[model samples]
Target chain A: MRPLFVSGLCIASALGAGLEESFAALRNGTSGLRPNDFEPFPHPTWIGRVDGLESAPVTGALARFDCRNNRLAQLALAQDGFEQAVARARERHGAARIAVLLGTTTSGILETELAYRRSAETERLLAARDYAATHGMFSLAEFVRARLGLEGPAATVSNACASSAKVFAQAARLIEAGICDAAVVGGVDSLCLTTLYGFRSLELLSAEPCRPCDERRDGLSIGEAGGFALLEKAPGAKAAAALLGYGESSDGYHMSSPHPGGAGALLAMSDALARAGVRPGEVDYVNLHGTGTPANDRAEDAAVHALFGAATPASSTKGWTGHTLGAAGIVEAAISVLCLERGFLPGTLNTGRPDPALRSRVVLESEQRPLSRVLSNSFGFGGNNCSLLFGRAG
Target chain B: MMRVFLHGVGVVGPGLENWAACREVVSGRAPWGEAALRVPVPAMLPLTERRRCNAASRLALAAAEDAIGAGDWPAVGLATVFASADGDGAVTHALCQSFAAREPEVSPTQFHNSVHNAPAGYWGIATRSARPSTSLAADQDSFAAGLFEAALQATLEPGPVLLVAFDLPLPHPLALMRPRRHGLAVALLLGREPRGGALAALALRLEPEAMASPLPPALEALGDNPTARALPLLALLARGEQGEVRLGAVGARQLVARCEQ
Candidate 1:
């Protein structure tokens, strides 16, 4: 299948909003993880939290849908001339011809949780509109679509960590199937008490900044991020990354852990390579599914080793961005595009020693090199995994 | 475009535990009964590990078990895809509670279970298969999105893929947003069969069809029990209901399901 070019991309994450900041952080090996400072938590854990969300005000019609998640979305959408790109899309393809698809895990429930606990004593229940806006997982997508004045198909993709990456596949299909001419796709997840405590309870939160593929890697650092990309069917577009191919799979082995040998991960990677019509040797870089968890790193290591042999140069950016959960795929996809565009591979910050199993294959520190095609992988619970291949547009 | 087929399906719900049980309910041999209140099997992870998993993981595991049991589990390079409207809300609520308490110590188990991919990770460890898996959450149309993702996986990857959709009632104050009594999980085995089974091609189309007024009672019944929609759709398919069956919001953007004869 021919690749669907990514015409424009923008991002808002803890590292700093906009493609320029994020790319600069990646190039400089900056760690976005920091000690929890927003809401008090029992243990001191690292998180990639967007600053100043509480004070960020929403104006115009978007005011009605204001929340931490929406605020993050607003910040991300403002990056990289994204607003101008959308306007151009509307002018070229009409507002009704473009669709909006967003991927998120929690949506606006973080605000809803706050509302439920902090409402004034006079308040009996949450305001109906606030409740409706923050309750559904589709709220974020709807907010983006409404704010952009887009009338085409607008839907939310929520497949855990794979949510946003899968949106690329869906948007491409919609355009190919004649559902729309162009689409805005990305993901957003904001820091909330639920996500913080939930991972803590699960024992997946790292006490320090995460060390992906490190032998001493303990677990992941939670992070919040919002990212968007303008996808179009046309192949030639300025400053765009092409969606070469994507592979998805499910190994119904367990509910929480991955297959010991990375079976599903292997399938997803091989499938992606097949779809992109590129051999494993043709790939320049790999964005790993390195959550920094012991089990995840081991499994993904085995999978990457099995397919690309011990020669592939790969690194997990989680150490820099923390695991963004549902937004991980899109965030990393944007980074991979940036890597291809900049002709360099971002270093895996905080990874001092590579896991012995991945010693030869894994790239621990950042390196600058010419690269044409890059692969990004995101695996989620229930053994769900997806791999996407991106290439420079001709 | 490849023609996707629903070769086999396995479901685990409150009243319907397996295909046989599902068949009984669909055939009216037994009452459709109340939703499966909780998971039926023992936690695959030890108590130490299990403590970290949330309700979504429990239901997802059970549903995957039923789906895998319907076919060869260890042989095929199956890609597992799980979908829900709220991914791990119970765990999310617990996390918030801990944060609100301002406690100095957080449970490691709780943190692990909080990742959206916890269930998938657990499934991978238990199965000892290294196949890839994905988890997805979309509001009302999660089931459709899961189905679409699974079909896309089946087309892209070799061998079969399992698609599981599961969601449990929200915890406490969060539940007030969309209240429901039970949790539901459904899994489908999608593959490329040589000849047998009915093939359904799913496509998203923009049509002028009016949004079905008030939504059909059967569909509305699904509000409280989102997983149940799979049963009716599967039952209809098992009975050889051919052609596209659209399942999603009605408007400028809807998920179009077209099952061809």
Candidate 2:
């Protein structure tokens, strides 16, 4: 697999609103999680809510698409000169030659939830909300494309947690197939009632900030985040890192639960290594999809142990951002690129010690080390799994 | 442009059942008529799994099952791309209604079933396939997006690829918002190499300022469903004719598919 350089990237997570701020937070161990403060129906769980969304509503020509999710997306797009990077890519490869692919689970369903409540109050038919533009699963992609002023082929992957991560794979194939020369791939999932109360019903929410891989780990701390990467055929000589390879697979077991044995997780990791032509030993760091759930951490530990053994330096950055759901893939991908660029390896945050039962060597503290390659894993509901390998672009 | 061979097809729409059963009707040989859309329960799934399916998943899996059965390759190893314009509308409506009513004890089953890839997940379990599968949405252009993704995968990899595009009318109130009039699903088995039962060779390109081919008069009523955007391409395949048709829009560009038998 030929590497596609990530010439430009931007991220807005619980940690901060751009690459620099988020990276600084990661370096300084500044957690962005707070007790449930989301208003009107606050569930008793920690959340990684982005700041200023209420005041930063989507405005201007795209105001009709206003919602928490798109606001998060707009915030990310405003950071790190991502919009400028996209503008450059558009000039280099025409608007129609750059595809827009994004991932999100609930998207603007938050608007729908609010709309439903309003309708119940009014006792009228569900009022028309620009359903397609605001609440549709493709709304994130549509908003991003229109915001970026690109006219390329576009689509939105909604495969749960694996949603945004899979967009990278889609962009790679589209470029390889000559469907597009470049692509703006990213994901955005904001705080929504569907996920909040939904996860609570599943008993998958941790009362404290998520402690990934901790022996006492209970469940995930849901977070809102958005991130994007510009992928192109040529390795931007000055680019910090490139997408070396990606692997995708399904559990074929259960929809809600991961395969207890981590069967699909192991397969996706192995495939990523094989495609990148990198040996397991070459993966200097591993980004675990440690959502802090006992089953998830344990299952992922088994898979990582089988592949990288007990020696690889691995950690779950979820402690920093909570589980960003559909945005997890790109958020972690951006973190992986940061690892390659800054020579830093982030340890699992919020966890004091690795689980006694877990076998993988869980790094408990952030460290500085030159790294050439890293693998990030994102597994979602419906048994969807994706592993992306990034390497320093020489 | 990207090229792929259409190896098999499965379709379910108003007045249509499966691809094998409706090919003649689509080809203009048999008289077309409207009937209530009945999405068969996915028997391919085990009982436990079947019970978990919603209308969207059932419609997608039924079409996928037929396409996989008709294709040359086994279902186990083929990659899949599932597209839905509106995913699990019924579930979304239910979840929102529960919250709206302040009865926030959302059903665990409904939460899991709410993911857009629920059908792909159910498909994986039914076929017991570990092959990579993706679920995407492109508003009304979902079918074209799924086809483009599938064709690209088939061209890049060895095995056949399955593309499933499906959508059902949103339950009212919500339906009052989006207004999809019918339920429809279409699946295509695409392979890089021509198979013995190949329907046609398709070349896909993205063009600006193009419109999707108008549905035949007989199939016009089905066009209200977003997934029915596949009807034009299917109609061409049904007649065993060589021609070009626009699949649908991708942002400001349109996907133009040229079919040759």
- Considering every candidate listed, which one attains the maximal DockQ? 2
Clashing pairs in 2: none
Q: Per-residue lDDT for B67-144 in model 2, tens only?
A: 877445788988899999898889998998888765567998999999999998898888888999999999988998
Kindly list the per-residue Cα lDDT of model 1 for residues A36-95, writing each as its tens digit.
Answer: 886766677999988888888667766877878888899888889887888888888888
- The parts of candidate 2 lying over 4 Å away from their true place are A119-126, A235-237
Positional deviation of A76 in candidate 2, in angstroms?
0.4
Predictions in order: chain A TM-score? 0.96, 0.98
By summed lDDT, the worst window of 10 consecutive residues in model 2 chain A runs over A119-128
Candidate 2 chain B, which ten residues in sequence have the lowest lDDT sum?
B65-74
Candidate 2: which docking quality band? medium
lDDT of 1 by residue, B153-245 (tens): 676556677788887877765665567676778887777663354334344344445432232232344456556546546545545555444
For residue A348, what is the lDDT in candidate 2?
85
Task: List all candidate RMSDs to the true structure.
Answer: 4.5, 1.4
lDDT (Cα, tens digit) per residue for candidate 2, span A1-394: 8899999999998898999999999999888898988856656788899999899989889998888899999999999988998898888888988999999999888867877777544224345578788889888999999999999889999889998888998898888877688999999999988999889889999888999999999999999999999999874337889999999999998888899989999999998889889999999999999999999999999999999898899999998898999999999999999989999999888998778999999998999999999999999999999999999997
Cα lDDT, all candidates: 0.73, 0.89
